[model samples]
Target: MNDSAPSPTDLLSVGDVSRRTGVSVSALHFYEREGLISATRTSGGQRRYARHVIRRVSVIQVAKRMGISLSEVADVFADLPPDRMPGKTDWRRISERWRGRLEARRQEIERMENELVECIGCGCVSLRSCRVLNPDDELGADGAGPRLLPEIPTD
Candidate 1:
């Protein structure tokens, strides 16, 4: 019987939340600092997190796995009211927003794949091949860079 353990009804300590969610304590701290998750402080100055933060951390993990940047994930969480934990509706809304970004990324990948197939061993990394490599940048109006790829929108 570990008398130091938090009771079932007590808010979870940062370590407890980390153990429950498999997220590092540092990451939890980062999330807290980034405003993706939040916590309260006990009178003794120990931090305490609500159980809902576990689910919130899980959602953040899933978003990261999907190639969504932390800023993008933060934007999604921004849609939720500060007082409420992300619920089913929140998940649905965020998922819908990510669906568009994911689909766009997929299409971009497909385009790059096809382009690479043609660019293989072409050795056309010169401006002379700009017609094929970058038709829009005929005079290098956009400056030096891989201009063929479309910019992925973060929002």
Candidate 2:
């Protein structure tokens, strides 16, 4: 046996985890700070992550690509068994939980598409007459700056 070789069960250094997962070291730190993933500290105070954290990082990447917020990912992770890698069943549950939010995003996109065509075809740049912008002058009641626009999704 090669004594120097790391075993599958060995805890990984932050750089090792970053290299293996293709997530930046700073991002790994951010994930830790956000309570998404956790690590143990060495006697020298270096971060050491369990091998299963690779799977957790993968899940974070996938969730980010799907426009899921980190808070939402954290919520899902809170329900997960921390000792093991997330499996097919875990992914299924996560995706199921996100389905409604994704569906709402899809509907929002469709609405934007339909309204975009109308806005362009009408050639009426007036905010008061813009259904896509003012939406029946609903913002008038709010009395605020740039209230003619919908809230842009950040995640």
Which is the leading candidate under lDDT? Answer: 2
| Residue 71, candidate 2: alpha-carbon lDDT | 92
Candidate 1 differs from the real structure by a C-alpha RMSD in angstroms, to one decimal, of 9.8
The digit string of per-residue lDDT tens for model 2 on 13-112 reads 9999999999999999999999888888879999989888999999999989999999999999999987778889998999898998899999999988
Worst 10 residues of 1 by lDDT: 128-137
TM-scores for all predictions = 0.77, 0.78
Best by TM-score: 2
Candidate 1 positional error at 78, Å:
1.3
lDDT of 1 at 144: 66
Q: lDDT of model 2 at residue 137?
A: 76
For model 1, residues 41-62, the per-residue Cα lDDT tens digits are 8898888987778888998999
Regions more than 4 Å wrong, model 2: 1-9, 139-155
Question: How many times do residue backbones clash in model 1?
Answer: 0
lDDT for each candidate structure = 0.82, 0.87
Off by over 4 Å in 1: 1-10, 130-135, 138-155
